[model samples]
Target: MSTYQYWQVKFEHPDEDEEELKAVIQGLFNYYEAEYGVRRLTSQVRDYYRLIGKQAPNHKRVQRLMHEMGLKCTKYNRRVRKYDSSKGPNGKKGKNKLNRRFMSDRKYQKMVCDITELKAGNGKKVYLEIIKDLATKQVLTWAIGQHTVFCK
Candidate 1:
């Protein structure tokens, strides 16, 4: 299927009024509240509009128009820790060379190091910095802090 049907939604030349569209959206929300006894965890209000014989606009368009009309959703602050794909395919990875190779003809010729984050407590974040020599496998330097913002 096309990402957006790959075709513009053609209206009847003269479309529904702005106020009417807002009213339809509001009516759907009211219906959802009444029938569902509060919005469901994964509720998309506009879905009800289509079920009730109303053409629901695209989600992005609904979001934009609703925001312009001072009607916005209270987004839940929920997130699941995502896998860091830049760290390569799963398993333990040292670091991304980007181009430079890790192999060397002689010992102590090159070194590789990496840094990672560890979030702790309720809000106060901690930062850890480490530097190590790949040739010797020796940790050269390390540092930790409450905030880990890097300088531009």
Candidate 2:
């Protein structure tokens, strides 16, 4: 099994009634399993206890206990991350002129465009390209169709 990242919630419960804590934990897991059909429900369970005036449990303990209870996030229906950088043609990489700054002096000094794909009613992916001006925050151009050919 793959290990989880440590974006986990941690706590030190002073009111450590063992049976009470176990019951609350069971309810949290049960609710999430019924609603989402997924075991990656840590955040939701933490939020539930927070709403009920109870301290959240240590993430390590919760994860260990959940695993003992046979709860795990399944990855059967997950799609693979697939992308090819060397497809078709070459593109120019511009200089790091702005250096991560979000502000500029002159209008249209720099422009950026991004494309998003949406699944249509007929199950076909439709691409939308949006070009924007930096200084004025205006949309310069846009096109809607089906193509992966991103260019300047």
Q: Which tens-of-lDDT digit does each residue in 54-146 have in candidate 1?
A: 665666655555566555333333454533323543566545553666556555566544445676786444666566665676777777765
Kindly report which residue stretches of model 2 are placed more than 4 angstroms away from their true locations once superposed.
1-97
Q: Point out where model 1 deviates above 4 Å.
A: 1-100, 105-109, 149-152
Error of 2 at 16 (Å): 59
Tens-digit lDDT string for candidate 2 (54-147): 8876666667666556665443445653333323345445566668885767888887777776778985677777888888888998888767
Task: Output candidate 2 Cα RMSD.
Answer: 13.3
- In angstroms, the error of model 2 at 82 is 5.9
